[model samples]
Target: MTTTANTSHNIVFLDRDSLIANVRRPAFSHSWTEYGATAASEAAGRLAGASIAITNKVPLRADTLAQLPDLKMIAVAATGTDIIDLAACKERGIVVSNIRDYAYASLPEHTFALILALRRNLLAYRADVQAGQWQKSDKFCLFDYPITDLAGSKLGLLGYGALGHAVARLGRAFGMDILVHKRTPVEEEGIRSVSWDELLETSDVLSLHAPLNEQTRNIIGSTELARMKRSALLINTARGGLVDEAALAAALTTGIIAGAGFDVLVKEPPPEDNVLLNLHLPNFILTPHIAWASTQAMQILADQLVDNVEAFVANKPVNVVG
Candidate 1:
């Protein structure tokens, strides 16, 4: 693959630290300048004279795109491209490509980790053991917490894509009955489909793997939480906006659902007033969007990122979004 040279093209990476994985600099013939971090205000100045720009979470709205006259392509380092203005890119004739299926391994493993923790009440039990409550008990162990098993339980999955399928495989291995909700109400031949309402009511464990969009935003609100069985567990390794954080907090506080495990939030590094931050409920587990950040997954992402850049330079791009 040919790289952009002094007179050929200039490549710029807006936020190189976002990947958390090692990226081997491509042997492209182009002159590449990467910034470890870039602020929203500095984006335009940083993209000056660049033929290709790369970003992970940094926003690239219409106003920002209008400033970069030379930018020909945008290569997102991550899978989700909601942060970018795809319509604006099309209007400007700027090609966009993103890494796909890089998290197939890490995400499903993380989903199961959350499910197991909630099922066993691991956090609460550990806390009780650490506080010497077990020593105070006359019996060998205390039954203060409830523990559920995966066998014979129903697993309802939303957004039955690659990640959801992987989760289903794990569920089957655990002897759990897996049910997938159709994206729409249409029926299929081989797959066992459930309506959204039925899935919410019947599932022992509900896991979300859907993307964030207008129809999906805040899909799991108070009404949906009310539909779940009091013993059911909710797991979201998907986007944060998929569930209403405030409603989730209320559900946990009121025991509307058994427990919840989430990897993503509506806001990253959520504000101080975020309700989930103040929740100390044993039934809740939250991780800072690391489900897709395993070392191996990050390596795949990095390798594919360079591949996208190379393809764009060759004028034969792959994984184009715009």
Candidate 2:
């Protein structure tokens, strides 16, 4: 653990509006300053005199950290720490902690929501209904969109952590077979362990639950997408960079696979030129990275964020990551 010389600390929350829950002050002698949002240029200025920094999506790169000599610790408001430079923090003796297992319920539910929506062609059918296609139909029902059942279909999970386990349980409830490819060995019953190639080729629905990192970034590119079944559905509730945005846009346009549902994008608040943003396919669903932002889940995350901060101040930091 990195120890600070100061008796009291200055804590600054860089992006307070990212979280929708109440963040109670830490149980220590510290000054707290919060901003609704922080841009890249404003980061160094906001965190100038701070000993501790709280951030959700704001980037704390090597250059920004170099300016904040007083920074002793970084309390990440979310699980993903890619926004902060871990190597830089390690070299500076800055303790970096992140929230863990906070989105177990909301994440899995959202993943399945995407899966079910794509499988049943819910969005396509909804658009048809809104366009009065159902009203103009001669038959009792409209079958313009092909609907598939989740039962007996294979559910492939990329990373089998707490979130993966929760998703597998839901798949089972929906009568879907579970197949997983994870770094660790599979020890759970009824879950079949498969190679990366087999998982890609076999699953009816391939869901990503892995964190964004060097090895996992752009893991699902053109070749990986081509390996999947033409009827397969791609679901990504995890990080956006896991799939190449241009490649995904091409795949969706070319019909390499059936469809996709994503809660994240490579660049959040994506620019006008983003390929995925320009795609107007009914099969492709792009949610604004709110898979883990349910009211219940945000409160859990908010409570845990304070816990991480409190633990670090007491010299017993939990969820301490790179």
Candidate 3:
């Protein structure tokens, strides 16, 4: 193979539809080939001569990476790079980049959506109303469900990053007291900081915005649930592994906590046998990992994806993770 400095580099975007919103292909000083769908078996053959590959959820493991000799960079359309093998990329001198902070708007909004729904028992009430329970009652409204207000409630934030801070602002806007649990033990930062135990015990609404890593995985389990107020609602809009799903089901079933809302699961499309799927509890709300799919956020990510690719071509890549 011959290398030409002035020749157009080949760029490919695998699984372009993985992005919920439109992605403006980055202005590349190269020819681009995009596939709306790319199977694992066809990845190497399709990318044989490509210089850059962009993927969102498609697996680019060592086996796939081994076959592409011309590949130089991978632009991940999303923040999480767990689908890609970073060590292999490092060893092979392949630059990897991912979008960051794109979900600051969408995720926080989704988190509160879950929190508000769970706190107000919206689902149960809706179900009751649909079941004609209100019509059967002699009273104007039935007290078969509990309805709570967000005001004066303590909002326990598990992560203090951008999303967590956004959630705090929303909580405060609703006149809810915001309490953040420090990731590490340090001197309290006045009213803003509190011990983990304090956040767990006193909060009326607990929300998790942390990532999934070895240290943070399963951070919310049976023991942590035990520390929470019985009337508290737990919300996780961050990652799935951060909470033990089975344990959470047990907690919900046993009334360990008042209610829970989650936007993610340990498995994306959870297996049919997953314990949480079988639970028809009105307190449990599970969304299909769409907290970050807001239109505005998706557009921002699309623009940034192109920016990263353009930067990489210019030897000045931004958002490089490896």
Candidate 4:
């Protein structure tokens, strides 16, 4: 939390348009600059002379950090800190803080929106209706797609943090039996702690809520997909790197698993050639990383973001990540 003596802090926000919420200024004296969007090549130049930088998705790597000797703090506008090089920050004595637990309601609700849509074949049926199958049917309703109930199904959860707990509660509300995979033993009441293999093989609906890191990237790939029941559904509102995109495309195309709903990708604004983007399967759903973008959630994040900056100015930084 060190700063130049009696100087106004120079704060710059890169990619300000990534958030739709109103960001209030920190309480202390400071100067602020913001851009609607920023690219990797332009990061260092834009952050030049900036002591405090706010970013949502623009990466701040070791090479970039090397150029900013005056930088004291990085306030990540989101929960994930993978975009920030923690090792480099620590080495440079830079404090990093991130927003946390602000999306508890929005994220879990979005997770179930995917689950219910996939389980009940809502998209498939809607497609059928658009294709005139319902009107051309011999019966009152078309039965071209399979519909399943979540009431008695097993809901598997990976990573049981705040968002995970919220998702688990929703699963219980739907009368699903909850199964969690944790590195350590799970002692929570009415929740079954299972091995990773067991979770993959037994869950009728698998939801990922883990962070993306060296140990978690591509946790669900070809082998894991092949082990799942052909009727099971996969939901990921967490990190995109948690699942292998190429493997997921193949699995959905070949019917290895019933369906999948994802809100993230390893690369945001995915490339034109990304396999998942090319898949036109009705069972697969992809959102533009908006599970955490509900109006209320965005405001909560914005408020907390200012809180982090203000706390650091007071030398009592809250939610310091690294």
Candidate 5:
């Protein structure tokens, strides 16, 4: 592979600190500039003469893209390209490439981590043990919380993509029967998918792997949650906006669903008043979107990120996103 990109190329990495991996210097010589984190206000200025721009979460809308006439390509550090204005990039003839499958190992593992913890009531038991519930029980064991085995239970998967497939494999190992729905109009011929209603009604554990878009935003709300079995568990490691955080908070309080495990939320570092943040229920577990941040996974992502840049400069872009 050709190393350093075009020598005259000016590359600006907007958020170098997002990845925990050590990014190697490009093979082709180029002037490189990076920032630990960048605000939208500082984006265009920092990208003044940059031939290439790299960003993880920073949004590059049409207005911002309009100013970067020198930009030839954008190397998105993550898989999701919603942050970039793809139409504007296409209009300007700028290439946009994003990393994919880098988190296959880490993401599914994290999903199961949350699933096992919630199903077995790991946190509640641990909290009770620390609070001296075991000592106060005066017995050999304490059955303070419910424990549900994953084996023989049904798993409702909203997506059947890479991450979803991996999670399904793991679920089968634990003896789970997977049920998935086909929401899009186009799918493989001859195969039928379950309806959304059936998936919600029959699922013992409903896991979401779908992205956040107009058709999917807040797909799981009060009505959807109400359709699920009272013992059903909900898991979301995909996008947070796919779920209604307010409804989820209400569900946990009123037992709309048995438990939930989420790694993403509608807002990152959500405002202090986010309802989900205020809920103190052990059944409602929330993580700050670390499902894909395993150190090894980040390393693979960083390596591919540079690889995309190198290939683009070579006049053969890979992983181009629409």
Candidate 6:
């Protein structure tokens, strides 16, 4: 518990506009400067005399970390710390803290929004109405595409952490049974832990909440897609690298699975050549990563961010990351 001997620590927030929350000033006296965005080339220079750094997506590589001897702590505004070099930060004696569980409610609500929209064929029907299907309909309503209900369906959840549990609670309210996938094939009492093969094969709705790492990257590939029920819906509010973009597009086009609702992609602002962007399928719903950007969640994250910095400076840091 090494308290910051200095009363005024120079703080620089690399990306402020990225979050839409009302960030309150820290309790103790400090010099604060913020920028809308910080490019890689500008990171070192912007952090030249800063002792505390705040960032959301800006990458601080080993080379850049080495240049800032004055930097003592990094307050990450998001849960994922992959953008920061943890090894380098540890070696340099820099304390790293990250926001967590701030999206527990926002993410689950967004997940259900996607599920309800896709399951009820909202997009497909809207397109039909816009294309003049109702005016020319021989009947009262259009039933060209199948519509499904969430009740009595099986929801297979991967990585049952805070987010996953929140989703499960919502699924149960919709009269759906929850099947948690066993990453290690262990059977837990009271909770049904299903095999990966079973989860992929039988689920009516498969939701992902896993983190992206070596073991989880490309976890849902062509082979996995082929095993799913043709009526099942795949929802990924997690990392985009967890699924193969090409395979997902093919799956939706060929009816390998019913639909997919995603809030993330392998690349943000994906290049022109990205396959998912060109699909233009109603069954494939894509959002611009707003699953965790609700006003409430952003405020919670912002509050925690300032708390992390204040605690660290007081020598009782919370949410310290390795």
Tell me, by TM-score, which candidate is best.
4
Give lDDT for model 2.
Answer: 0.92
* Residue-level lDDT for 52 in candidate 3: 90
TM for candidate 4 is 0.97
lDDT of each: 0.89, 0.92, 0.85, 0.93, 0.89, 0.91
Candidate No. with top lDDT: 4
Minimum summed lDDT over a 10-residue window in model 1 is located at 183-192
Question: Model 5, range 1-322, lDDT digits (tens) per residue?
Answer: 0123356889999988888898876677698888888998889998989999999998899999899999999999998888899999999999999998898989999999999999999999999999999989978898989999999999888987888878888888898887878556324432236789899999999999887777999999999999999999999999989999999999989998999999988888689999988889999888888999999999999999999999998988999998
| Residue-wise C-alpha lDDT for candidate 2, range 1-322, written one tens digit per residue | 1222334888889888889998887889888888889998899999988989999989999999999999999999998999999999999999999998989999999999998888889989999999999999999999898899999999999999899999999999999999999887698899999999999999999999999999999999999999999999999998999999888889989999999999999988999999999899999999999999899999999999999989988999999996
Candidate 6 backbone collisions, by pair: none
lDDT of 4 at 262: 95
Residue 92 alpha-carbon offset, candidate 5, angstroms:
1.3
Per residue, candidate 1 scores C-alpha lDDT tens digits across 1-322 of 2233454668888898788777766556678788888887888998988888999988888999999999999999987888899999999999999998888999999999999999999999999999999999999998999888999999999988778878888988898988788666524433468888889999999999888888999999999999999999999998999999999999999999999999988988789888997788899999989999999999999999999988888879999985
Please say which candidate is ahead in lDDT: 2 or 4: 4
lDDT of 3 by residue, 94-183 (tens): 999999888888898998898888888889889999999988999998888888899998999887877877888788889898888866
Question: What TM-score does each of the candidates earn?
Answer: 0.95, 0.96, 0.91, 0.97, 0.94, 0.94
Local error of candidate 2 at residue 313 (angstroms): 0.8
- C-alpha lDDT of residue 163 in model 3: 81
TM-score winner between 3 and 4, please give it. Answer: 4
Q: How many backbone collisions does model 5 have?
A: 5
Evaluate residue 67 in candidate 4 and report its C-alpha lDDT on the 0 to 100 scale. Answer: 97
Q: Distance (Å) between predicted and true CA of 242, model 6?
A: 0.9
* lDDT, candidate 4, 1-322, per-residue tens: 2222334898989988989989887889898888888998899998999999999999999999999998999999999999999999999999999999999999999999999999889998998899899999899998788888999999999999999999999999999999999888779987999999999999999999988899999999999999999999999999999999999999999999999999999898999998898889899999999999999999999999999999998999999996
| Alpha-carbon RMSD, candidate 4 | 2.9
Give residue 77's error in model 4 in angstroms: 0.3
